[model samples]
Target: MRPTGPLATIRNRAAAVAYPVFYRLPRGLRRWLVRRVAPTYTVGAVVLLYDIDQAGDRTGQLLLLRQPGNRGWSLPAGLLDRGERPIDGAARELAEETGVELTTGQLTPATPNAVIHHHGRWVDVVFEAQAPATETTLRVDGAEVHDAAWHPLADLPPLSRATARLLAHYGISSPHTPLDPQPTSGQPDQPGPA
Candidate 1:
């Protein structure tokens, strides 16, 4: 139950005055308290690993990972570990899913900053990187990621909900892009689920 009337005002004022004292606590305790009291949401990073077919030519081919189970095809994405930077998270996920390693500077932000859901629950931070199509070698573990392939923008396989939405936000402009059916407007969707 929430405090009401004078009690609510008192609680707010107390918290405001105690703000400095709160910072004196250990970092781990502070994080734990925040998680216990604050709303929960995930911060994920996704990468559009584009390939250049010819020298200085954009091929429109991007790497997609075929994750095991019902995830279908999706981009290189994963939730950021606690306190991980977005670019570092993107690079880590890309290297983990596909055997392509890239420096954080090699990736560029694809969205305005991060793509937040309408319900303001989860965020998908997008990044784009380019590599030579012929020179890029992809290796998947065949378990976490069943396959890794470079798919042209004109032809794409059935995509997971997160991938579909992120692509649209990145200006794919494909009306026929098959987006998964969402449960409802009020419900927040997972950026990527196993």
Candidate 2:
């Protein structure tokens, strides 16, 4: 039987009241509860905008943003809205975070969907596009992104794990290497006093 009139109104009101409370819980708990209640999964997209320098040995520079909340440097990314296509979501997130508008046709798939498991399982669709090296002006949304800059494929700051993995998948190595673990002196390693 269809819920009509007061019954429907009561159900709607109950959901409205419950949703905020549910959202306030820690992300892990919220996802756990949601999974128990329904089949819940999230889809996201990350956009890697590259500028190919035809004159500079045909090198490419990739755009990255320093996101707020210590998320580290990442490509512009966000969760897709319901009923939205992955390409469309990529375009939307790119425009929203970087103020760079792109048509859906311009983006090419960078990798197969990357499944990330954390508090919630996420399937991230990655996309990349080539932009003019000199023409594009990048403006970051201050609330989410603190800064935006383009780095050559060989030089990059500390990257978020997902971003690092993406670059590794593409076989691109960043110039920012970790300090060597070996001591400069050729001495036997000694353990600290317990």
| Candidates in order: C-alpha RMSD to true structure | 4.9, 14.6
Query: Lowest-scoring 10 consecutive residues by lDDT in candidate 1?
Result: 185-194
lDDT of each: 0.78, 0.71
Which lDDT tens digits does candidate 1 get at residues 1-194?
Answer: 88789989999999998898889999999999999999876788988888886675788887888887645578898889999998999999999999999999899988566777745478878888998868888988888899899887887777776677667666662344565565565233554531
Structural similarity to truth (TM-score) of each candidate: 0.74, 0.65
lDDT of 2 by residue, 1-194 (tens): 87889989999999999999989999999988877988555788888788866553335688888886544477888888989998999999989988899999988988654534333345667888877657788888688888888888777877765565555546665555332232344211221100
Q: What TM-score quantifies how close candidate 1 is to the native fold?
A: 0.74
Candidate 1 all-Cα RMSD: 4.9
Candidate 1 segments whose C-alpha is farther than 4 A from its true place: 1-34, 118-120, 173-177, 180-194
Off by over 4 Å in 2: 1-39, 54-58, 113-120, 175-194
